[model samples]
Target: MKAKKTTPQGNKEITDLILDSIADGVFTIDQGMRITTFNKAAEQITGYARREVVGQFCHDIFKADICFKMCPLKHTARTFESIVNMEVNILNRQNQEVPISISTSILKNRKGEVVGAVETFRDLSLIHELRKEISRQYTFQDIVSKSKAVAKLLNILPDVAQSDATVLIRGESGTGKELFATAIHNTSLRKKGPFVAVNCGALPETLLESELFGYKKGAFTDAKRDKPGRFKMAAGGTLFLDEIGDLSKGTQVKLLRVLEQREYEPLGSTSTEKADVRIVAASHQDLSSLVKKGEFREDLFYRLNVMKLEIPPLRDRKEDLPLLVDHFVRKFTEKTGKRIRAVSKRAMKRLLDYDYPGNVRELENVLEHAFVLCKGPEIKTSHLPENLTPSNHRTAPQATGKTSRLPELEKQVIVEALERYGWDRSQAARELGMHRSTLWRKMQRHGIEVP
Candidate 1:
């Protein structure tokens, strides 16, 4: 009934109201790319009156960096159908190179004839300034954080790094344990020495032993030549033992001796070699709990726990999301050679609200995933992973950079489409290019009951 009541005048008023109410600048153009409509937001952003821009060419008004090549609006009008989230720097009326993210959608008539195109652009000048300030504030090697927990840890890291005492870093999987270890090493007295890392869980007990302590020639069947273990290789520097909880009891004894006597021997050699490396160990499993379970050596655990650093998960420090998002967007943009500059308000809202059980690594993966699907300068809601949708759960499989979970993704798209259409199944079906009956059937298949 509501859809039926949307007359031409009613629709125009609704469109005008939306454009005025929204914070992003919006404009429309005819098939010839002549500006047709300029919203209040556009007037404010570009410092131009709607009267002045209505009949002018868009390129003349904005002077976009991509007007000559890879123009998003041109692409949509020429061959492509839509342009969602293309970032471009445009000289405004003041001649300032203001960065803005533009999303374009083609307008069509009842007979599906292309009539015009509408564009929405959000000013990113303030965001850029804020990103610079935050970057200056949170800079610590490769670590970019704005959370109080990390800030406090960063404050003490120099002191922690100065000490030669054994350090134990604890956190969930995907948390940057080795990053902390490397930071400690880079800040320590042995900053110039090699920072060697070995994963105790990645090898069998024999291979791990050989891997930690260099084996003499003929130590094993394929022992071709002498090899220095991570400890010896890291002599005068730091040796990071990752997943130390996975070490066997026999290997634990060897490690405990290395900690106590400050020495270790190769696989086949009899004489003990001096252990000059500083030990920084990390584990996802709680070593204290492992000790209680009798799976870990209490003595070794005590030695490693001399200076413990627990990195909080992403959900605990969500205040860092905006900064982290910006950091990742810039990073991936460089790697992909794309000009993507920002995230849409709706997509960012979903990112802020969701619980990241996978922590910062998962966050990186999400952005990487977005960077792939996003063809424009911004990451839109439709570009995000399906599991990140409000209708999905964190436990759902991450379709990160892959189409492995197509059905789940399809369901989420349908749900989002329905929500966008105010839960009107007919409208949603029309937008999705499917029959209303098909939409209803798919909803039933996905168990999506409308409220």
Candidate 2:
């Protein structure tokens, strides 16, 4: 009888175990590029069975028909060294494009000659999904503010959603005018339709016009093919024109015509296309002022401003500051893999006191900056921007300080802190550096509800 083949000890077993245990997919191919081994993770990622993949050309299985096309294995073979990282699109068994981070190394024999290549990769689908979900959740309803102005806007959103009327959103920059526009689109009857957005300020007149009303083939020097503009692409949907105040007079005339006629002719196209789209225009500058200055057309302003919505700046809605901070903290923590616990009470107070000229966008930026600099769980006053800090311990009150009474200020600060801490009084008190009883007494004095 032939002698029983005995399995080798440590080295081979250790390598196999390590590869199998990794969450990332791992595979090996011979010099001829035929797959030799495939791990379980590889099976999960590519939706291919090991029995089916082994012995097949790696390019065939990966659908990389063009061998020179960003193939990590080819790089490894030429360098005889590991290609540590690269992002590439791979086709799965379903022929879906899958984004993956690939790392590859050339396997060599004792003679220092390359024999084959081994590759490891991680599927990016889960990470991409998580990021999308987090961004959607945080960036949408996460805008913080408790001013009656904002509350009134929120209350009116459902009604606005029910209408197909043109919406003109007005706000200072960084006050989340875009967020409101998105909310309107998402809640509208055309929610299922595409919500195409463009920043009018980002493009010059010619480009902006071309972007809004796509050009036909050979319309311009670089026009190689016909293109559908944002208006056409967003048919039966919503088109968000951010920074609408920046639009040139000529563009305004074209937009006004589209709004009135619900049809437009593409550049260099004789045929007019019917555009069934809802217009949501936003501007940091006052359209009325622009119209008065003759920089903006009165007819266009009236056409676009069928239903108006205004977003208050952050400082005006001090009651919403804490909630906004918490929302941002959770969002940043998830994004950066940090363990930030809370923002300090003193810090919250300072934040409430400051005038946020940059508005909510600025506030988010500050929090993001703080998250980067923060070493501990709690974000303290030191983590905040320098401008937010009080300039002097003792200073005379402003001439108009009487407009904001001390009691009202205290009430607003307490309410903001509570909201920021998700209504947790203990956390709020701890942040305020005051006893719970003291805070309760103050709340009672101000006739503020605890929750």
Give the best candidate by TM-score.
Answer: 1
Flag clash pairs in model 2: 322-420, 345-431
> Residue 51: error of model 2 in Å?
63
Q: What is the TM-score of each candidate against the true structure?
A: 0.60, 0.56
Cand. 2 TM to true fold: 0.56
Which lDDT values do the candidates have, in the order given? 0.85, 0.81
Report the lDDT tens digits of candidate 2 across residue range 388-432. Answer: 544222223545645645455567767987888898887776555
List of clashing residue pairs for candidate 1: 85-376, 85-377, 85-378, 86-376, 86-377, 87-377
Give one digit per residue, the lDDT tens place, for model 1 in 303-407: 899999999987888888888898899999889999998899999999998766456766787888889899988899898877674534532657577556657
Return the number of clashes found in candidate 2: 2
Total backbone clashes of candidate 1, pairs 3 or more residues apart or in separate chains: 6
Model 1, residue 246: C-alpha shift (Å)? 1.0
